[model samples]
Target: MTDIPSSLEDVAEACGTRAALALLAHFEGIDLYFPHNPRPDHPILQALGPEDGPAVCHYMAGETVTIPNRSPAKRRARILALHEQGLSTAAIARKMHQTQRWVREVIRRAGEDDQGDLFG
Candidate 1:
């Protein structure tokens, strides 16, 4: 078996093709090529830190899949604004047309403090 190369260019060179063509095929097409070296480095991956490395999944037999982490709490707070509009749990539930349980949960979460609020 051929060893995986440490760099894209090296891989392309080993495959007897131009690096750009290899990149285009790997990036634009359905097939994915993992490095033989096992721990190849890319500029974007380097920037994200090892713990935040991108995950790869396959859907179709040869397709690539990518999933990112959920947004931080501060970003999710935008959705909480709807609860702060002084609507009753039942009314909020009706306005959002969500289940009462969901509406209550949102209100509870919105009012929670360090000690946690009782008026959820």
Candidate 2:
């Protein structure tokens, strides 16, 4: 079971059929690597049933599943690791799928964490 965001699940669970249906529609054609029922042909009426249908949109989402560097600490560590591997700024940008500016910022901040103060 993938780590689905509790907020998304909670809201979908409580917001009734209209909301559930909308969420279902939003996830249309999405591929999920989780335990979900992807029976779109079952119609919206079945989604209104007393089951876990409303919450899970059959698409994987959350801090764990999609985003590799979810936290500031993890992001910094990843940046430092890739930098140590001698990857260029542009390569790191491509690997991290982040802007070159953001990658530079992470590398700078992470360097500061490790070296205390390079300028001092």
Clashes of each: 1, 0
Weakest ten-residue segment in model 1 by summed lDDT: 52-61
In model 1, which regions exceed 4 Å deviation?
Answer: 1-79, 113-120
**Per-residue alpha-carbon lDDT of candidate 1 for residues 4-106, written as tens digits (9 for 90 to 100):** 2333343334433333243333343123443222243752234333432232211112333231212335323533666566666676555443456866765
lDDT digits (tens) for residues 79-116 of candidate 2: 77999999998998776657788889888876676775
Tell me, by TM-score, which candidate is best: 2
**Candidate 2 RMSD computed on C-alpha atoms after optimal superposition onto the true structure:** 11.0
Query: Which residue pairs collide in model 1, if any?
Result: 4-36
Give the TM-scores of the predictions, in the order they appear. Answer: 0.27, 0.42
